[model samples]
Target chain A: MLGVTLSRWTMSYFAAALAALLAGEVLMTAGYGFPSAPLRAPETLVVVHVVAIGWLSLLMCGALFQFVPVLIARPLHSNTLPLPALVLLLAGLGALLAGFLQLAGTLDPAPPLLPVAAMLLAGGFALALYDLARTLWPAQPLPLPARFVAVALFFLATTVTLGMLFSFALTTGLGSRPLLAVAGAGLPLHVVAGLGGWLTLAAIGVSYRLLAMFMLAPELEGTRSRAVFWTGTAGLALTVLGGVAALSLDAALAPALIGGSVLGVVALVLYGADIVHLYRARKRRIIELNSQMAVFAFAALAAAAALAVTLIVLGRLSEQVGALVFLIAFGWLTGLGLAKLYKIVAFLTWLECYGPALGRVATPRVQDLVVEARARTWFLLYYLAVASATVALLMAHVLAFRLAAGAMTLATLAIAAELIRARRLVDVSAEIRLPAGAQRPHLLMSVPHPSP
Target chain B: MTQDYLDLDVRPILRDGGEPFEKIMEAVAALAPDQGLRLYATFKPIPLFQVLGRQGFGYAAREIGGGDWEVLFSRADIPAETAPAATPASATPSAAGASDWPAPVQEMDNRELEPPEPMVRILAAIEEMRPGEVLSALLCREPMFLLPELEKRGHAWRGGFEPDGETYKITVRVGETGDKA
Candidate 1:
């Protein structure tokens, strides 16, 4: 194989993340904690962290490690960082899961591993951040996407710090005042920082570039992109500041929180409009399946936003925040991840196997690497299951959530299988081949052929 | 410029500054294998040099009068010192002559585009290119995916990041390596 410029461990990140996603989805389907699982219940915490840290964060980190250099036009400062980080993360996740199970009384003598796990996870993230930050440093007047990612990294560092602090207080029994401070002021602020500032903001930044480029439309470098960036930043800033004030001074910053939430919504609207414009402006007349399905992910985000606003307006915000989060995580964030992954796998596979064969003889295009006709149906099924599961979880119907999760788990596994097939160059199973003197290149059974 | 060859004066048709690119191309294609093409333009036409050169054509140019450049593109096979242009400027009622200029290679930028889109666009453009044309793309990173595809199709390519490390440029010539590779 020709030497590839991408990070050596990049695919390992994807493989690890996908494995975690499958485990997390299966956990949800198992319904071990059931109706008794409150938002803060140890079992619930296990599931949340499994999805957030183990799956989504890992996926994002892998992608960023690969794309950050590409985005900033710099070679990675350190290629070795991912291996240690991956090891630390997976190890920390195991410890954290055990600690949570102990808290839930499912594991006797689980040994207070939260603080230890927290430190390991923090170490892993810190190392990852160092590599990304170094790459970003040389690209001054950073592109809009890089700008967003920079802020998201800062938020991620903060999120991990706070989480470690929480674990430290619980395990070591020190800093009682600070521990009480955070617990009293509420931990929703922490959740918001991770989900809103770290995850969503970064996703928005990445998609801004990806969507426009993929659609063959002009980048949203105008007012709309700026609007999303600034407003989203301001909203997150307000929330973080308010959380600090509440924790330290015991002040209730309700009005500031509301103001922040409204600003966040405004940012979302601008971003949504920008995306719609991109779709309309696309020169590629036909939309591919991955992009077509990503529309639903965006719609899911919009729906979640609308629900949050309605709950806030009706004075039932506290009661419904959980449901809104569910929608955002499973419906919006995971949906986008799945949709994008479907295409990304095929692309990476093509690069691995057949990239240099272009314009030479007959070679399969990237689209041909994907069995989209089969995978496309899975996308629909996954989204449908997500919607049903979201509604059931919101309605607090345990049985319904379980049923929907089962369907989702199955759909996810089916799609994942296709990804594996593509990665291994098993598309040869389709028995398609391109003959000599072909005027146009298209998909066929992708057997790896050495470039002439 | 010295009138080494005034067999075809395209100056009248170029008054609108290469008004019809198609017409310019048609005048080019009309040149017989033994003949050459003379074009009058206001500027250097530097990009066209590369475009036509890839098709086994070479040119010598000199200023005619008042900023007009008279460029004579001829088959490189012709002994350059004596071969001269012969087509009349008003070779009129011209149907769009097949483009004699090596097909213009399309250039695209796919920096920061999601994976596969860049690959998709490049492949699509390559499929549509006529023989001898090239396509150059500016990318955010080295297109690791494109190299193999190019090799398998027998098209040759070379790329490297620009001096500004962020901009990567790759050039692919369709059907053959031509001279650029």
Candidate 2:
């Protein structure tokens, strides 16, 4: 087995992503966004961008930098490119947030930051997409996981391009009629492409491989996995088509959206079935805590889909859109991200600190790095708070939602602390750390020294 | 033409993490001139082929279910036609062109194992091997995650799915710098 080399900038990306997540959660708890402000208000846009680009996008990119190699059994196109991409993304996000503040009149006479942010973000995403594409190109007949990532990258390009168009239209004030129409009606399309296609699809793909590897289950490259990919792709395509139609004020948008939603639901059902199969067929009798906790995230996905369908059937979807998005963003995506990070942080730490010494020394198992008992409480609390928040949003209970958000922030902080402990080798036995060859890795960055 | 044989089962010793090399050697020394040795172990005793090959033995190996392998080592000087019962078509050393790549120093049945474990075992085994030594492994799937790591560590490998199209067989040659750890 070839070893998975440490992606030098992955931790930094994770660090920035976590900070963004905390910022979003804190903002919500403080009543800065959404229900307190109108959905399309500048304040709401700031919170949305902070979470969408700053947190989820960064997390996905970071994971891809490390796992894409494992997926295709190839190294990244350039190890040196990731740091610059991160910097560009962060800078772009900062400018975008400030630009939103300027639009809200919170900042006086700020430079027209929208177009500048747009260029920076486009450049950043371009570098990332190019690096990933080149790495994926030579691996012909890619495995199922790599194929998912490839499609996801395509959507990411769509997402970034659409975003840039919106930014330019907002800043330049010389947009074409169609372009202005897109900016007016394309927000849903942007969210669908970014959240559903780029982020969720990539998460599904990576999770398939990671769960199988962690659970000792057989890889799911069968008909079910193929169905998941095709259906998911087709669903996204139809949704994007609907988005385009909406931009043109065409009557076909409604049917296309409905059809796409149905297909997307079908894909989710198949994916859920595949996950059950994986868990049932796993060879490891006693599964780890991370895998166990991920069930909550899966359940959230199912619940969110079910809620959306019910809302549509009851003709209340427009009113409850906020609740649905909240469930999807926090309950599904963020929940899964947090659960996986619990394991990935420890796994990468072990690889960085002990991978070279593997087979030569008595290094600790990956499970030995974290106190799951302590983290378990935090994970449970986090999910409960998300659930509460979703219900409160549906009931339009602003205070209740804020309270739930505060609990979520606290839970996230506790889980993050546990991750930091794992990184610092706090839970690893003293004997394992005190050995002659054991080196305590730097907290947030990998040292460039060659393997001992 | 039928030779007497000595039987040895080192599965328990291997399972207990004990080295069975000295015991295997003692059995070899005690073998009668007209006798061969029949070895039964949990995995194919690949390194032992060269060890016994040096002592003038040509071996025939066959999987005997449940990850166990039976290898019969007979004197190579005996003509193949005369030792039909013991010399199967897969007999090592007697097969032309196959002898260039030395018998693997370590053989692993990673077919039942999961990901990372197979990678872990193979990497650990290679780390213990001397430079230029070869190790063989049978896996349930293509060793995708392990191959790049091998290349990273300067080891060389060749692999393909077996006739069954399910089992993947790989042979890795440890590089000069592979054993640096």
Candidate 3:
């Protein structure tokens, strides 16, 4: 079997991630974040962290738990550790949100909890990183996808470390100049490391493998893929360096940032081209719903990159940065995450339920587990709502943005419902009886069985 | 568990540009359940290994002098009372041992098929195979998703990319009680 075991807690992580996503979306819909509150407001920070750490980080971690083994062609080091890691992360996120509320004076009677949140989050991330690293350690000279994940893990550590420092600074009253500098100037660095390095780079790497596998296209293992990795890594490094330099009040920050942005754009462009090539060369002429919806996410990524660059060039980035971040977070990263989850959930459920029965009795194909016709509308609604929200943000139309956010929340809820249905085997035909000894899996929890 | 051997040589047929497959199958059909076959050919017959393997014949092949090949096809269900004196000079032994597996009963070329379809076809095909029967398939990519499922269903499989470095070939042995052989 080549030792590839299914990750038991991946569904649990996904459930938590989706809940966080819905929470973030609902918060925005209720006018908690910008365009309602100032971008720097603690209320906005609460929403941002809810989405970034709660939704995206959990989603990525869950996926990697399942896929890193596939990428390395090895079994996970430990399956028991993920549930505890998830528990720590959720608790940390809860504390972090509460701390933000305290900072906003909404919970003035509460003690300072940012440091506690930081410690918990750091511990959780550490455990995850250790488990993944142990799995990857033996498989030296990793494949391209695995390399991306390895690099992203480094950035994740850096992001968490920076966040911890910020939390401490804020809690300690930021009296020292260095602490003040880290608290004030390091926010952008944290964002770049977390969103760009940890999240986007990892997403790009994973997508390269997955898209090719699903499409049955030739994997991009040649010079182009190498170019993407090198450029993307170098760009993120330079940008992060610039942010560090800014904290130290260095004169080299501007040039470093500019150079980094240019390289990042080049990497993204190459990646976009590679995706197009995959679609063009795909053997499956009929594109599946997940792959089709991922196109909008890719477009959003390109648009966000272009818009950010244009704003930077015009020296108007600060003024419109809120809208740009909204596009990147909701339209690009979250969009891609949601789109892929639709297929991944179905695929995993099929493996769980039908795998044992395979070749022993009649079984439904993985495609049979998902009704694309029902999901297609929700996906369309999601992208449309995100677009309208982005437009409203650009126009500084607060009420319009809120309405769009409400629509986005609705679409996300509908998609989540579909994912749940897939997990429950609700979409599978009743006529195809499950083979003897093959039982339906739980929706959120994995039932223990003898190891294969 | 000793059985009488029926000797067949296809080298002369190949020298005259005649197809030997039909003659080979005819010999296979004529053999008693307790009998085995000794085959000689001008070159190593890789495809025939699977062809006969499906019929519950374990094989051991060795290269003879002057580019000729000698192969022994034995019934796998029978206990090996004695090891053949000639070591398997050229036969590639799979996980279950080369001489312990029968040829694939069902063969599929799933190169152009998409995800799940290839898996679906393979699983469905194996369900119809008799216990101890083997199936062979060719796929465009390594059947990553299919491998675990095969394990879960208690089937044994060996696969690798062909010499072309693109096409993947897999041989699966149906397990007793739908368990791994």
In model 1, the Cα lDDT at residue B29 comes to 71
Model 2 error, position A425 (Å): 1.5
| Model 2: pairs clashing at backbone N, Cα or C within 3 Å | A1-B146, A2-B146, A2-B147, A2-B149, A3-B149
Candidate 1 stretches greater than 4 Å from native: A1-4, A34-36, A428-452, B1-181
C-alpha DockQ of every model: 0.13, 0.32, 0.28
Ranking by lDDT: 3, 2, 1
For model 1 chain A, where is the 10-residue window of minimal lDDT? Answer: A438-447
Q: What is the TM-score of chain A alone in each candidate?
A: 0.92, 0.97, 0.97
Best by DockQ: 2
Between candidates 1 and 2, the TM-score winner: 2
Off by over 4 Å in 3: A173-180, A249-252, A433-435, A448-452, B1-102, B130-132, B152-154, B176-181
Model 2 misplaced stretches (Cα beyond 4 Å): A1-4, A249-252, A447-449, B1-99, B141-154, B163-166, B176-178
Interface RMSD of each: 6.8, 3.7, 3.3
State how far residue A25 of model 3 sits from its true place (Å).
1.1
lDDT of 3 by residue, A241-327 (tens): 666766667344567678888999999999989999999998777889999999999999999999989999899988898889999
lDDT by residue (A393-417, candidate 2, tens digit) is: 9999999999999999999999989
